[model samples]
Target: MTDALSDLARAHGVATAYTTDRGHRVDVTPDTLVAVLAACGVDAGTERAARAALEAHRSERAARLLPPCVLVRVPVGDGSGGRGASDRRAGRRGGPQDPGGTDTTPPLYLPEHTHAAVQLEHGGTVPLSPGLPPGHHTLHVRTPDGRQACAPLLAVPERLPAPARRTWGFLVQLYSVLSRRSWGMGDLGDLAELASWSGRELGAGFVQLGPLHAVEPGALPDPSPYRPSSRRFADPMHVRVEAVPEYAYLDASARPAVERLVERARQLNDSVLSGSSLIDREAVLDLKRRALRAVHDVPLSPGRAAAFAAYTEREGQGLTDHATWCALADVYGGAWRSWPAELRDPRSPAVARAREELAEAVDHHRWLAWITDEQLAAAQAAAVGAGMPVGLVHDLAVGVAPEGADAWALQRCLATGMSVGAPPDDFNPRGQDWGQPPWRPDALAAEGYRPFAELLRAGLRHAGALRVDHVMGLSRLWWVPEGRPPTEGTYVGYDRDAMLGVLALEAYRAGAGVIGEDLGTVEDGMREELAARGMLGTSVQRFEYLGGSTGRHGPLPPDQWRADCLATLTTHDLPTTAAWLSGEHVELRARLGLLTRPEAAEKAAAAAERDGWLAELARLGLLPDPGGEVAALHRFLRLTPARMLGVWLPDATGDRRPQNLPGTATVHPNWRLPVADARGRPVPLEELPRTALLRTLADVFADLEEESPHDPHDTDRAPDDTTENANANETEERHGRPGSC
Candidate 1:
């Protein structure tokens, strides 16, 4: 690649080369760089054009007095301890000077005699002061030339709030955990029940749920929550019609039709619970839509009507745009790009007219959104009311489907000819194309990150904690050009400081914790950065190992685990503990041709890993016999310094299937399996408390709680002492083999 092209790409935050997971350096092709730059609205078709673009970019930056956005870190100490305002001004252009004239702090960059002011997000305006509170505000600047400019100013806290103490919770795939009362799949009501029961009865601190983002509506709804129609709204399919307060007010004449739908739902539930059928989301949504339409016919009470009106007003144009997209999709298939030119643009007059023509349909969709919001709020309230310190932790998918609502509605902000995906590495030699459109970095900043902020606010509204899937996307994303293989993709950088500032601001405002899924191929120092920002990371037990031989690889010592994490036995993308222990995942992978190597080789590797873990368990004195592996694993997790530990609900019930198997979309039933017992019979939520296996697992956690009480001053205990004491207690208990805890 020419130096000019490389410089242009760098100016636009596109990396020319990157190191893969295996430590090999790969340089992005010149053609790929030009294509990506074009997608970002930069003209770099030739060497001359590239040089011109680079020069223009540099000129723009040099001419601007203020950046497009500014992030100001709040001072750490009280006003009395820091330098006085006059002293701070003296160091405005140079380093701060101490009484002895030594440079004490880094140089401040604000220009001299430049008028600066800030307009707070809530109400008042104030001069840019040292002690200003943390918020999303606007900064106004007047240069010496009398030229004025405004930028989005973020006054961010040094770190987010941490959990008061070590806590435990159930990590759930919400749709898979069905109940006898659900309409074919688990709904918000089931979520509430699980949260309340786990919090009140089992003392769980939270119920982490899968992404509830709205899926594309069609005859066969997309079952993957990661590729959603709109991240700003919840999926109505997860709403329980009967749980809606208005359902009780349905007229006598509508009761028969509702009963018929209820019967259909019961049959659907039976098919799934019997373990003979997979979750049919399309059928489930069809039945729920019919019933919801019937309920919509009933007039709302005065109080309910007012509440609905208030919600509509608060949501404003965003809700209207989402509902309008749904209405249009119903008319012209799900993919908006295939629609007639007149109706393709969301802001076009033709599309506006079409929305008016389908006003009733739009209103119905809007009502669905409102009801879903209500149920989500209720579920979070139930969690906290049942004594959970952190309630519902909602998952936020990295991007939206290219043909979905957000893509059509925010077309200007999404890249036109690029897809977000991962580059080829050791594990996935073929890489992956997620088929989701990435946000145009330039457009995002130009829009002041309004769309991103709105999505975050929506997700955090009813959540006590929020988990950002692929959290590394906040700093950079792999952008694959249209028609190119994922291996040809290159990394595109984003404004990390601004993105994290907005996230921390919203999370702080909501008084919630943030957990970043920093599991796979994270960049160096990313984990430390997340920890420093008070955002927890995810750690899975099986992958946490020390260097050693195949059959003897040592499990990472419990005390070595980071305390700022939500450690788990496994994640939805991986196999359950039972499956892993039994080598079921390897067998299934072989059957589906998903194994890149020979079946024997894969099985041998899996067996060696399992054996090593078992050895570690025995060394800790946590294993009395082979039958106690599950209990022993839980005991091992409890010993970790992780602030929060997550119990995979299916693991407790001895489920032997993964919720999702990455790479194979059609060959394996991903995201469709129900939570089942050892015999593979689906277990409903109501039956969980009564199950002996679940009760035993819960007791394991209870035993650990009894052994270790909260000690605020005990944060710095020696790792060796802690591990030794835990092992000693386990050895003592193993003498008599206490019944399951």
Candidate 2:
């Protein structure tokens, strides 16, 4: 690539070259660069276009007195110690003589004697300075050269709020954890019951669930929560119809149909628990929708009506847009790209007319959103009421489906002809196209990151802590051009400071903690930065080996683990603890033809790893003469100084199947299995408390908590504090689950 083109790419936050996980520097091709630039609304098809774009970019920067947005760091003590990378990006750090504040690192770019004031998010205006309070504020500035500008100003906390008490929680795939009360699959009622039982009866701290975002409305909508129709709204399919307030008020005409639907749902639930079928989301949705519509026909009480109105008003246009999309999808299909050109644009007059024509349908969808939100709030309330310090940790997926509600509604802010994905790496030599549209960085800045902030707000609304999937996307993402292989994608950078600042601000507002899934190929300093901002990182116990060879290396000792993370034995996409110990994962992979190596070799490697873990457990005295490997693993996790520990809910029942298998699509029944026991018998939520293994795992955590309380002082200890030499060959695993096909 020519220097001008390279410079233009850099200016636009497009990578010209990047280092692979294997340490090889692969230069992005000129064609790839141009295609990516085009996605970002820049024309770089030729040298002339590249030179012109670069000059224009430079000129724009030169003319701007204030950036599109400004980030203000609110310190720890008196708001002076919360400096972050945003400060450094703004301008050079000033010394003691600086006029802003004691910890004001980033000074303004305004000329000397410039006047500035900030309008806080809540209310009131104040002069822009170090004393500016934490909020999503607006900055009004007048430079000495007679230039004036305004920008979004974020004064965010340096770090997120830490968990009040070091505690252990259950990490669950909600759909898989069906209860007797569920309508075939797990619902919010099931979630509430689990949280209440675990928190009060089992002494658990929280329940971390997989993404519960709304899925597309269709017969065979993608089952993966990681790929959702709208992140802003909770999935209505997860709503417990029996729990709706209006259910009891159904008139005589509707009561019989509702009762029949309930009976049919009961049968469906029985089928799943009997292993006669997978969790049928489509059937469940159909049953619930009919029952919910019948309930919707019933007159709402005055109080309930007011509450629903307040919710719709608070949600504002986001909910309206989502409901409108659903209404349109019911007619034109889920993929808005195929919709009539006039109707595709959300803001067009045609949509306004359609929205009016389908007002009742829109209202029904809106009602669905409201009811889902109500259930989510109820679940969190139950957790907190049951004494969970960090009540519910909600998962936020990286991006929304390209053909879903969010993509249709926020078309202007998302890249039109690009998808978010991973570049070619060791684990995935072919790379992956996730088919989720990425946010346009330039558009995000131009729009003051309203969409991003809204997403965080929605996720954190009922969450005691929010777990961000692919958190590295906050800084950058691999952008694959339309119809191109993922291997041809290049990295596109986001304003890291602004992204983190907004997250911190929203999280702080909600009084919630943040956990970043910082696995896979993380950028240097990414973990440290997340830690600095009070965001926790994820650490899977099985992957935290000190070295490569199973016999020569040992599991990372408890004390060696990072204190600022949610340490667990495994995640949804990985093998369960029982499966890993028995080498079932290897066998399953071989059965599915997903193994690149011979089955024998893979099994041998898995066995070696299991034996190594057993040896470590025995050495640490965690393994008794007849102790269970699953309990021993929990005991090991308890020893880690990590602020929070996660017990995969399926592990409590010795489930061997993974909630998701990364590589295979239809060949493997991913995201459709119910939580089953060792013999593959589906275990209901009601049976969970009586299970000997579940109680045993609970005892493991309870015993440790009673024996030794966590020291808040040790919460932020670095993972390398122990004496073990962690010089393991860093072959990064594929970090996240693939987007649902």
Superposition error at 424 for model 1 (Å):
1.0
Report the alpha-carbon TM-score of model 2 versus the true structure: 0.94
Query: For model 2, how does the per-residue alpha-carbon lDDT over 1-741 read when each residue is reduced to its tens digit?
Result: 899999888777788888877779889999999998898889999999999999998898777777666766776452226553232233221111111111212455566677777788888987766666677778777766788888877777766655556888899989999998888999999999999999999899889998999888786556778889888898899999989999988899889999999999999999999999999889998999889989888887899999999999999999999999999999988889999999999999999999999999999999999999999999999999998888899999999989999999999999989998887776788877888999888788777778999999999999999999988888888889989999899888877767887888898889898999977767666777787777888888767877521223677777777777898999888899999988899989898888888898998988988988888888999877244889988888888778889999889998998888886657888889999999899999999989988988888788434433344345474435332233234337545555633
RMSD from true fold, candidate 1 = 7.3
lDDT of 1: 0.78
Off by over 4 Å in 1: 75-108, 547-552, 625-627, 703-741
Residue 224, candidate 2: how far off, in angstroms? 1.1
- Model 2 residue 254 distance off true place after TM-score fit, in angstroms: 1.3
Top candidate (lDDT): 2
lDDT of 1 by residue, 1-741 (tens): 999998888777788888775657899999999999999999999999999999998898767666565666563332212221221231121111121112222333456778887888898988777666777677777768688888776676667756766778899988899999987789999999999998888888899998999989886434677888899999999998899888998889998999999999999998998887999899898999999999998898899899999999999889999999999999888899999999889899998999999999999998999999999999999999998879899999988888889999999999999998877755566666777898887777666677888899899999999999888777778888999998898888776655776787788778888998865555545666677677888777866754311112467777766677888998888888999999998999888887788999999989988998888888988888433788789889888778888999999899998888775566777788889998889999989999877777777676333333222225586445432222222111000000000
lDDT of model 1 at position 610: 92
Model 1, backbone clash pairs (residues 3+ apart or across chains), number: 0
Cα lDDT computed for each candidate against the true fold: 0.78, 0.82
Off by over 4 Å in 2: 76-80, 84-107, 547-552, 703-731
